[model samples]
Target: MAQWFTKWIGWVRVIAFFGLLFGLIIRIGDPQPLETLRNASFDFYHQSKPRELTQLPVAIIDVDDTSIEEIGQWPWPRTRVADMVQLATAQGAVAIAFDIVFSEPDRLSPAQIAQDNPDIPPTLLSKLTALPDNDQVLADAFAKSRVIVGQTTVRTIAGNREEKREMAKVAHALIGPSPLPYLLAFPDIVQNLPALEANAAGRGIFNALPDPDGVYRRLPLVMSVQGQIRLGLTPELLRVATGGDPFAVRTNEAGLEGIVLARQLIPTAHDGTVWPYLTPSSRSRYVSAADLLKGRVPQGRLAGHLVLVGTSAIGLEDFRATPLGVAMAGVEVHAQVLENIMAKTLLVRPNYTIAIELVTTFILCTLVIIFAPSLSARLLISLSVVLLAGYVGTSYYLFVGKRVLLDPSFPVLATATAIILISTVNYLREERQRREIRSAFGQYVSPDLVDQLTQDRGTLSLGGESRELTLLFSDVRGFTAIAEEFRDDPEALTMLMNEFLTILSRAIMDQKGTIDKFMGDAVMAFWNAPLDNPDHARAACRAALKMIEDVHAFNAKRRREAARRRKARAGQKRKSAPARRKIHRIKVGIGINTGQCVVGNMGSDMRFDYTALGDPVNVASRLEGQSRYYGASIILGEATARALAETFAIMELDVVRVVGKAVPETIFALFGDETLARAPLFAALCATNSAMLQAYRDRQWDQAESQLAEVSALLDKLKLNMADYVEMYSGRIADLRIAPPPGDWDGVFASTSK
Candidate 1:
């Protein structure tokens, strides 16, 4: 269970890293939460340090409450408006723009009054009709001055008055693809009266679009109205003020870049909108229309200044929310737009800023994922704080120094989330590793070793590491024939095999060995893994001897039980005879080898085992197989024998090459422990065995036979069974006598089977 979690920990991190990046990509669509965060940051920037009103090139001719009271309400006669226009032109104003649209003819006009009142005398009506039309008078005044009339876009036309609507005349020099697809479109426009629109030098739309929070931060400089492109009131005012020929709209595949007027470029957002860095509403920027008309305005106030005429009366409902958290007159917004542009203080969020923000966020989040697991909690928190501060600091600096808007909220949030998730995964992985260590090694190793493994987890590299390990492989000899005794009762066979394996496994665990796995009747184990054991070779040899001794005890107990069962069956009645069952003695061969190997968890990510892999492990299995051929209970490779040369009674078996190996390995057979090694009889037996092997290698068949008999006699004296060893050489010597070995024979016997 721990292995399963351990393998997926890395996957979890990868998934989280890319998952956060995908979320950042989704944020590019500007979901509500992310947009709110970004907008709040931008709002805070403006609120903290609004644009300062340095030079007032733009002035508002506000029709304030005082003006409304002084001038007798709105919708005043066109003659009165014409008089104000004439006065503004006489004051040397460069351009006068109306934020209010004169969409209908003045009802106070003399001709309209005449038409409304039919009861008047025919001669009086004729005299009134002979007087100049009020709209015509306003048109004459407009023609005499540089005036820009206002228009507004609507979603739908109220009635079938489209034929009477006048479109603004704008010359556009496009540089790339058409911007119609990228602009805010409206089906119709509320145009000024034909006379006022035709006489004006320029006409533009006065629509101030608000953000989602209903705050006017950015205003469109260009828009699509009735399938035609038209300039905003402020941009048109600049055009007339500079006398620029045509607007050079720069664009690319990514929507609008900027618009050029009089060779001066004005950068805009993708939708051709410009963010007006607004100042606090100041009374100094406004002059009452009553004051202007009454000759109360200062002399130079209107000189060289572009004036915007609009109503600020509360009854007009022209107020808008600004980023400063205050409601401002809509006309004042236009005046501020012109002021910002003319003063070169407009805030710009370039199109590439989004791409830059996304890339930065991804990189930051990736860094968090990569480092969060390794760093301490305190260090991670400090780093996160630094990173967040850096983002906000850079954004604030750009906003204050460069007048550029870049939001840091999303990056901060994303990086923090990555850190949290990756740290959590790391924590869980460590916990799992601890559980795995305790669960896997609790019974096999000592408590101190388990504690060491748990405390120093870096040593438990599941990916693998090369180490010198003493590997042991053991299998039941002739297990197929043994199993035939219980073929009709498989449950009994399972019980017998479980008991037999338990004894062997306990022997290995007693010496702090790791059980790699079991292959039916075979058991594979290794030492000097997961924890260091300098005496691993000696420990493995001891385990092998212990397993053989335990098996012999198990056989004695089984024989006693079988004999007791037979006595009970014989005493039963003849008509109720018990079923007869064959009993087999359990014998095993163990092989031990010491060499360099890679030991760790090995398998697929989903399922893996802590085991060792190398040629040494395979050689151990082949040595165990050769034990049966030599009639020995245990066998050891040259490395293991060399380590315990004097510690145990070991005899050289042969110099034979195992399957899959080109080099011959010197093999040894285990007889007993140190007590037997010091025994005089064992020393004599070893001398005889060495002489027999020497004579066999020298091709002296007669002397080899005589020495083999002496070796058998010593084995009988020691009460040991090794007839198969004597018979194997006897057959080999006979074969060599019949067909002598080749001249190049080096006394090395290469095994043909595993």
Candidate 2:
């Protein structure tokens, strides 16, 4: 009877504990702790899986540092601003939204200048005063183009309450509760000049109200100003772009549900706001406003693109802190919001998210309390982890799969606190055993290896077995010249090499290849080890192609920088210093081979690393060294080429016997993969090249020379440079003609060096 009573008391205590935690979390609301956790959740999601490029045709016309340098300073003449509007409209821009506010008349207008100077002649002053006003010119441009002027909702002021607004209509109340009371409200509005505002197609409030922590996460889609609902800049632009129409607000008993604009339903919180998924800032999204004004922007750039005009100059103070990065351009915020809306990838956290979180917390905490007192230490720990994992998995499922957000951290935290409180004594007693285990293994292995050992100790072994793997070796061509350029600066050399390695390594890893090691400017990697990949050969080939593409992109960027520097120097009156030595046609040679190899932990048992060894590895290295001689960026051994023949565009180079191997092997150059193979020109070249190779191998000197001549002529007509290969083949044909080969010749070339 006493035991039953004690158990009942324990159940009562558990219920009371749960109630306490629940009340605490609910009372805290969006306080510092919960806000911090929410921000952390956002950061984790953003850092782990950021949004890709949006399909929306939205762009920003940034008045950046370069634009400022060329077009003088900020608050550029209103006529100039008008010219920008005209240019965008001329280029077929559907709509133009100003992130800038034209709240006052233009000070640079001729009338304003005439009024400022009284000493001018009366006739000249009268003419200047009679000239068209700059503000009026800008207003006329706005009237001609599809434009949306910006406004700001500020704290209630004395005179602005009576001001009229073109407010949004609450079309249909789909369910019981309305969202007006929950929305952010303000009494006053900072509007544009009457001339401009009257001419614009629409108006929107550009209110960048950050969260309590000053992080701009959610953008208010609709807000109440002076008891009148208004749309945000993003939605307003869309409305203008697709015929002007008022949006309908949908609601349920919980409050706001979403906003329906035409046929599209945009999910929003109870407060009529949306959580926008941000991507990194892109220069591609921006065209210089100055460029538009000067008519220097490329044609069709503004065509069918939603252009937002704003400034990114640092002193403009139009920057906002976001999860993507701090001091991000404010214009990008609206641009991404528009992008998410159009792409239908906007993040939403409905009112029910909180209710679901509270219920989950209560259930999880109760389970932890019930299970903590009855299990062994290890089982308890495992159970706790399982519960935590389940909670997190559910949360991520909702986030990634269901496109909903549910807070798992609060519940998991509460559960952890409950378990820790209940198991403190037991945990203390077992700490010594865990410490001993750590001492035995911590010093000898990496943290990842240690984790693997703890999960399953059976994997600990010294010897390795053979596996069929795809091996890759890449080396920088003309690396000595590159080193010479950086000889005076070792730190710069180190940084450059690190960046190059990182780019190549990333290309390999992105294709799921494991890097074996870095040998100076070269890197060796393998696929289908540590993790099995059926597409290992294809992945290695793709990685080599990607590495080449990366190098080309790097060289193009450098060339642009060099051009900019040269231009800057040319404009200077003083004699400029000699231009820095530049690297042109920066190239890398990649070799790939597929065959059997030994792969596992290598080196002494006390200190070892995962690596591969065998004949295939040696051959892959040798082929990489030979890529330069073949005048190809990528070379593959026979096995790899055979595996990928139908997938990649292959050009058979030669059959060669390396120094150690007596058996000659066929090798080929990889031009491109499936995409390139589909090209008509590439296919034609491949067919012709194959015929030429056959004639050369058959010892038909006259036929081979004729085909080679045709190939060279075809290459010239196609503007393709394969001169080195053509020259090498020509020399081979000449030498063979002078000294005929033995009748038993198998057409094999012996290479004495690796």
Candidate 3:
């Protein structure tokens, strides 16, 4: 029935393309924490992947763009942030934070609330209860040191709208009675007063509030405060910088679960707010509220460094959106939660991260019952890169060595819904066996392995898989004397060797190369595997310079069909005899070598052929038959010329020992391009091939026959190729110029045959 309504309109266009990517990830909302840390650094290089520097610095003082061009806007007043907490407790800073919310008071110098009440009237109701009480110079720089401040959180509903806030809590801030009735009181914005919350040692409630998809991931650590649970200042400032518990919180029924400090539990999932802290704006940390009200910088950059101040200016929208971007700075998400608890990453989620997503969808229905229909988009992308690096390396090793919280977004959405139900049963068996080997190897290889072999075609092998190769050998230079001048109707030599083996099999399948047959016109290919490539000598020197630039564009279209058959027989060619043209300036050569041969499926199990074999594949077909006596159109051997060092342009050429081997190596000369070899007689034939291979590895045969007689007088004054390896290096420099032996020779010259 019209293929079941085109497979139900292609599964309703794949469920409306993941419901329009979950409604554009829930129409991007949940921001604020300096715009979710400038959209988590605009999703650092577009939505996470860069974990890089072994990932752990945890550094944020960022009100960014150099703390808003060295601090000023976004609410900068509390006696100019009490001289940036006395210049971050004189710079050796390990902790000085604030996502901001001094809560009122400092209406900017109405004369510092008459010296914070110096006994009498400086009146208009004492300056009308005289403003500028920038929280007693921020509680005398929060009584000198380890500062952290910020408070704001709200959530209420039950009965005649009892939402009333008048915040300034900390007097005897304890709550231990436990029944977990959500509360966190204090905030008609008390803007700090009771002696700046008794000279503040620390405080944290920046309330990270995300989850309408603007993604904060999670960080609410603890929530309720007046009926129970109170924690927050990023687990009480990483439990007061590792000394532990400014007040511990442990509740049960898995709500405010175990946020430890010394005992460690710390890995977070944040929802009740607290998650903003990220860093790196500079190590001069966060000084400016006008350079700490003019005492200029330095006291060891504030003793212990968690230092944050808010409003990274752009008119203080406090930016947001983090996994590490928008512009970054909701106090660097508590400086990425004190550099993720001093570098513990603390992002994990696998407390059996939903039982490892039901055992990765029961091992994807046991690999669709062992490769249904016989899988092979390269074994379903090598089993989706070994089940995505074994489930993101077992959730990044339970968040960097068991800190924990492994839910890698629902086991990466149940491994993309079990690789989309084994790729919709491998897209309904490649749409019911309609195989053109996935449109003939989908323009050769990757389309994510052709949509993982059209989702999973029964773990494929299609009779081609073997290993142990090193083949390559090119031809052309007078192809057997140009096919002995094409004999009579050899059907024009079978249509010019089938249009030159279809232009050398489409330039060896456009460098994704494989061809192992064409010997009549020479072509043999090999790399990592029938399909792997671990940089096979840079994919066989980029498929021999794309088969020598498609044989110089098939000898420039047979020299424009032999100049239009000599201008369509200028003055009538004596019948057919004049057609003896189209030799098209030959030049194919190319040879390469590397070992460990034998790669995949030999012919005859209903004619198979994946190809590759050994003896470095007949010494790369005897260095492509010594490239027609060395005018070389690309040759290599000293182990594919020292396994391609600094990617090509070699020279050293020859030490012979060919025609079925006996160790006499040195040959090189892929030729030209060390930026045009360095001119001056190709830089003295590369300094007489490094002083005649260090005087022929110190056997010194008359300083290797005076560096092979100045490399045969610089290849006869640079017309080049001093043929047949220049009298095979002057007959091995006259048999080592008469019986010379070696001493400490490490110039490994060994290769006696094919």
Candidate 4:
């Protein structure tokens, strides 16, 4: 399992790399969500540090509420508007522009008044009809001053009336490809009356379209009206103020680059729009139209300043949302554009900025995916913080120091998202490994040990270490015959094996032992290697005793079930063809030994198992085989017997040399726990058993027989079936008496079979 994971780990990073590329692709598309995020970032920059105002070259003549109250309601007769133009011109203003369009004839004209007031006397009506027209008067005022009339575009022409279109008086020249296709286009325009437009020095469209978010950030300097290119109000004002030179529009393959006028290059976006760096609205830039008309404004207050005439009255509904989160009058927005253009403080997002942002995002996200797994989590977080800070700082520097608009939102958002995804993947992967570890070892060891290994993976290793371990081997005494009973039904055999193994495995795990493997009907287990256990010998002994007790209970239950089946069959009326086969009871022999052994994961690199290997392990297996010969259920090696002698009911079984070794080992039999060991009955039996073993080894046949008779009576009292052991010793003493032993006789018994 470990080898499989190592072979495929690199795929995770490769997937992350492609994911970052997809993010970059989405950035290039500039979806609405991403655009909104970028716009918000730019808004924050503007709000934090708005454009600084020094000496503004433009002034707004606002038709505010005061002006409406003092000068009567709006559309206050073109003659009154003509008076404002005359007054501002008399103040030595360089040029004046209107943000208002006079699209209709004046109803206050003498002729129109005469027609409306038919009830008046004929003589008075005739005299009033002969007076000069109010519109004509306004036209005359325009002819005397440098006035740039404003026009606005409409989406549709109202009614069926054929509208007359008047072209602007200014000339336009192009330096490259035409910009008409890239500009904002409209079907119709609301232009001034022919007389007013004809007398004006220049005509420009005053249309301030808001962004999708209803915020005014960029204003178009050039637009197409009815298939013809027209200049904006502020650009017209600049041209007329500087001797009305022809507009020199520069273009390239990407679209409109900028507009050149009066030897000054004004940068613009691809759509011929300019991003105005705005300051908060200030009263110092505004002069009340009421004050000017009433002769309250001082002289030279608007002199040398390009003046804009527009209404700021709330009733006019000309206010627009600004990036600074303030509502500014539409007319003031135009004035700000003029100020920005003249002062060269306009914000510009160049065509290459998107490229720079994309490259930065790609590079940063790629680095995150590549290094996030190898680096510690703390280091990764710190690096991400530094990178994000640097990106924000660079963007802010460009915005404030260079007047450049480079969006930091997309790059930072993309990189941060990448980091989160990579970190999440790593965390999930490690969690899965931990779960695998728990699943793999949960059955072999106690839950506490499994949990410890899961929490601290560093403790796990794939190599061996030498340590003192108690090894156990348990096997069904008659497994071959048991298999023959279920040879026709292999599934039943499998189920029987699973049931017994589950019981034995539970016993071993309860003692905090690690199961090595299961071979056929036998189970091998060990302790004190993966985790330390000073009482491993006692634990192994306890497990063996538990196995014996549980197996006895299991066999009793099986015998009852078998008896019930036989009685039910006998009660049936039908005759059986042959008697049913007898069921066999289950029993297991356990052998335990304690010694220093090398224990760890052992196998091929791709597959492995945790097990122990040493001479002591071999001796433990040999003792298990020797159990059937001694008619014992459990046998323990000398080392393990000594460890448990004080806490368990153990008896010395024999000192024998097994088939594989030359040295003899004293093996003991385990019957019960400390309670049984402290019983008086067990103590009496132990004394008689010791005397019988000593008499037999001394070659005293008559005394050995007498002691053996007492030992058999004591074993019967204890309900132990060791008659085969007593008979074997009886036959050995009889043979020794018939044929005298050689002088080199020893008590150590040697077995010829394993």
Candidate 5:
């Protein structure tokens, strides 16, 4: 009966926990983070699926760089714009839209020049004013064709903006609750010149606001200005091209359902915005304005098409960011919107999407809670991954097949959290005995050893014991310089350091070594401690070599990245290539020592840590610090080198007495594996180096100097940079030449500090 009650209470707690999580997600809906996830998911869908190949019946008349160069600069005489419009109309265009706004009167108009110079004679001024006004000439061309003039909505000024009021020509008929309260609204309107706007068939706002991330992913179909709802330029052009049909906008309590035209229904969000599916930019979608005027454009391309006149010239400053590329013309944004509408391939995130997500989260969480308690941790994790994959797959399918924007992050997150919570509960219940063991040994041993202890708790105890262990110490070189690189961004520095340390630690663990602890940018680890391995020395050596290989690969990648960045900056001519190509490489020095050491918990009574302590451990640490002095990445004590002499290519470095130690120790550096050691050049150098060391120790100064010279020449021939090793021998010889050592002198260098 007690077990039954406990199980019932456990079920209650699980349900309550999931219920609270579900409720929180529903209340918050899709916050910025969730929205960002949704956007990324949609972008993935966009990239994976083949874009619609049905060429949009729309064409953009671009004032591209070639057009601007050939036809002179922008604000080109109003007469020239009129000529392009006339040519487009002659090519049988169904409707023409001006993405360019004639907000101010033409500056070069005769009447404006006359007003600028008050000294002009009255007769001349009368003749100048009498000449046909350029604005009127453009109006005459507009009067002859089905042209939709673009306008803009602006923020409210300090005073009354009555003078800037311009009504959009499209009529809006509403059904159900009005969506104006939810629509993005502006206070004033910037319209084209009165003569030009009055003569056009229709006018609408040409506003294309980007998403929070600065990508043009959606098009606002309807916006409000000073309590008045209006259609945007593309919608207005569609309406005018369809014979000025009135649009009936459907709405419910949430906001908007869609807009109904004469022959098609366009779906939208609550605020009457539509997500556009963009394709890669195509040169075929554009016809240069100059080509249109010069009759160079193909005849059938513009016929019966809705033409949007805009510029792709870089100097125009009319570019927008898109998911597909760095920059796209703003006019192409409108063209894609119209294309999606006509193709009936519009993407929509309706008001009920949140409800659907909530249901998914609730159902998934319940399923996890029901099955998790009976399963082991491995199976539970597997089940959780499968459930997550299913949710994401379903969400992606809905997006690809149905054009629905459903967020999978919340559902997946909720399920994962539930699995974790229930799994923790199971752990607590099933591992009661192991929990007691962990409570005692967790702080002193690694998790692996702790588990082993649980299996056989007799092998481990709280006492000091001596074992043959290989201790490794690794530290970053030039860490201060690396830190200074990000002095202003400490968080970034922390992330970089953590990433590097993780890779290094992984390298060590990959060789079956146990990490004892991390000290700043350094890692201390040991082998053959908790578990007896006869090859611990070889494993430590391999781990050190692997660390060096990993750092080299990392530096190569950084250098390549830096080169690409520099090339990009150089192409822009903003700075010199050398100035932008500063690459900072991260380097590490590792040292390994093999000997018998006391491997057990050591510290104060209040707190103790599992570590290795002995002369060999101290030697390993000193060698790591000495590696930079020798200009080598890995330096191992003589014992470690002897253990791996048959496997690794080791070179003798020096015999030195480190600080606080009276005994001299021999250190060696690694070159490569056995294949490198078998090379003839390496064999010869090693033979000559050994002879040189023997001669120097025997006080044969002339012989020692001659052998050292031979070693230097061989190193130069092999293109090896072992200058530090050569410098040590040269300094020793020079000192002996000045003041020879006594006959008892040994070939050992003494170091005063670590």
Candidate 6:
């Protein structure tokens, strides 16, 4: 009845857990703002770099207050403006990008039609009037050099046009692009601009900027006009600089929606708005109109650089608000477009956003269900923080690598759920466990061990043991020598060593062993105590074999990599020193053995440790240290080899009779268990070693030597030197003949080194 009740409660918890996950998914809402923030953040990260100017040929001719005052009024004559274009080309300006629009003919200028020509000869007046307007005059100048002109789009409201043509244009340009982009006092405005767009290097539309929050953070790739999208400045500048035809722009309601750059997918959210990345310190890229008329600036400053003409003229009232604050000139915005193109730092969002959110929701609630309530709030919070940072950091990396923005909403919800669920569970479980767990385990165990004991209600105790356990020790080979030779930064060295140990631990865990702790370059761990995998000998041997296999692969990779380095060095201009690249290489040794001893917990009365206490554990540790001398990765005792015989493939190495031992014990290498029963390499290795091992065991010195030679020859012939370890055995054979074994000849090799 009790078991049935417990089962029922477990089912209820599972249902409740799933219910929470579903609820989280429903509450996640749309991640628009979060997605927007992701784009802005990634864009800001990109745009924060130093704005290095490009070498694309572009010159900005400004119509400033000085030009207005020195050259008389804002509306200059078409002929005078035409002369400026001719002058710029004469000065060797490759491209002239105008920041103004010429929609009407110049009737006020003396060179143009006279204002009083109302009664002049109809043919003569028509000739004078049709001779040229600012557009024609500019066209004449543009013919001398590459010219790109900027125009503002005006929007006109439809349906209510009869009521308010005046006020409607304001809302029209704001809501959508106006017909001004295509309007001209001519028979065909499309053909004329198409010709102009053809004559000049490129033309672009300058439009609405993202308001106050300083978001949008990147300019749109294109802007739409009357169902026809025009290229924005950066891309247009690029297209012109690279000599490509003008790209057609198409807009959706989202504004300046997207572009197909090369073969990639660059998504845009704005229909026609400019996404400006906020500069940290400086103001807009404003070049004074006064400086342009009198060449006061350096020739190369604007020479071949795509210069955007915008007003930072104070109180022009173009500024509104930004993350850094407002007072921004509208013209500086276009300069940003130039910067974005040079860096290719465009922010984009993921195509499948909902799927990402659902995954985050499911994983978060499931974790809460699995863990007990007593888990620390601090621990849960730290884990949640790691998850959030990982999510955001991954998003940032992907944004930089793929130009794809990630949904940040899932991370936010997951972080929130982690904190709430863990906090709630901890509160509930602690109350339930406090009374029941103590009463259950208190009779057999003391007050302290009760906590560490969580297997069952009346089962174990908390941390307070002093029992001795076998402490198997393993370490990488040649580390001391390697450390002595390596001259990299101390922090980097530590990180590399730590990474290697982490790899080692994973292999250890694969064998069902519990890691006690790590010390700088060494690892100390045990088995059978923490979670009680009683077949620890089998587990430890399996782990040791895995380590050896991993090492072989690592060494082969290093050899190939070293070859690459040599080749790269040969290609360098000067061979002063080799360039450093990241590579991980190392050798490892393991020692493990099993025996019956004081097997219990060991720690302070208040905080003892649970481990085994016996001389066998010490012998195993000492054997690990002996690995270097024997030219072996691991050396295990007779008992461990027997225990692992059913699963592991072993190589019988010499036994060890250390101080205080009653007799020498046989040692063997645990190559692999049933898992690697039929690997060709393993089979080949076993087949080769069997012949040489049999000869050596018979003590036929010459025969054994010949067999060893044959083995090496066969391995060399196969060209399969996976480990190439027989050479070490050959050296051992040579040594053994010189120093004939004593009468006992107990194969044990006592290790006396640290």
lDDT of each residue in 193-265, candidate 4, tens digit only: 9999999999989997887788988999988887788899999999999999888889999999999989888
TM-scores of all predicted structures: 0.55, 0.56, 0.34, 0.58, 0.76, 0.46
**Whole-model lDDT, model 6:** 0.57
Could you tell me the TM-score of candidate 4? 0.58
Distance from true location, Cα of 218 in model 4, Å? 0.4
lDDT of 6 at 127: 71
lDDT by residue (tens digit), candidate 6, 1-754: 9999677457536655766766665546644555555445544555544234443343345555455555665566756656665555555554555555555555664334445666777777767666555556567666767666665555543343333211111011122344224221111111123334445656655545453355434455554444444555556555555455434333344343344443322445544333444344243243445555566645545555555544443324444344333344455555555555455554444335556756765675566555534356777667767767777777666655665656555556555765575566657777798779687778889867775565454323433333323346888776766676456666767876766676788888887787876766778777776565666776677677777777677678667977888776664434375556545468787877777656555665477555555777677777787666655677777777667664665666555566556577676655456755456665665666677776665556787777677666655554534233566666667888898777775444564454
Residue-level lDDT of model 1, residues 456-480, one tens digit each, is: 8654445898999999999998899
Ranking, TM-score, top scorer first: 5, 4, 2, 1, 6, 3
Measured by TM-score, how close is model 6 to the native structure? 0.46
323-433, model 3: which lDDT tens digit per residue? 554445456555566665666654444234545545664565345334533566667767766776686677556544554534344434434554566567668767766
In model 1, which runs have C-alpha deviations exceeding 4 angstroms? 1-9, 121-124, 157-168, 423-754
Measured by TM-score, the strongest candidate is 5
Which is the better candidate, 1 or 3, if ranked by lDDT? Answer: 1
* Regions more than 4 Å wrong, model 6: 1-145, 149-216, 220-232, 235-472, 555-578, 581-585, 597-601, 605-611, 659-662, 672-748
Provide the RMSD of all predictions against the true structure, rounded to 1 decimal.
33.6, 12.5, 23.8, 29.9, 6.6, 18.3
lDDT of 2 by residue, 1-754 (tens): 9999677558545564766576556635756777678777866776566678755688888888777778877788899889888988999899999988898788899999998998999999999999999999999999999999988877866365555555434333344456678788887778898899889998888896887778888889888877777888888898889878667777777677787786688888888888888788878798887777777888998789888888897667899988765558988999999998888888767667777777777777777666666678789889888878987888887767655767767777677777777787446656777767777788887766776766775445666779999999999889898888888888988988898899999999999999999999999999999899999999999999999989888888778978888786665423546757665557898989999999988888698788998999999998998787778889999999999867997878889887688888898989787876787777777788788889888999888888888878876775656687788889999999999899988888888776
lDDT for residue 648 in candidate 2, whole number 0-100: 91
- At residue 484, what lDDT does model 4 achieve? 92
Candidate that beats the other on TM-score, 3 or 4, i.e. the better one: 4
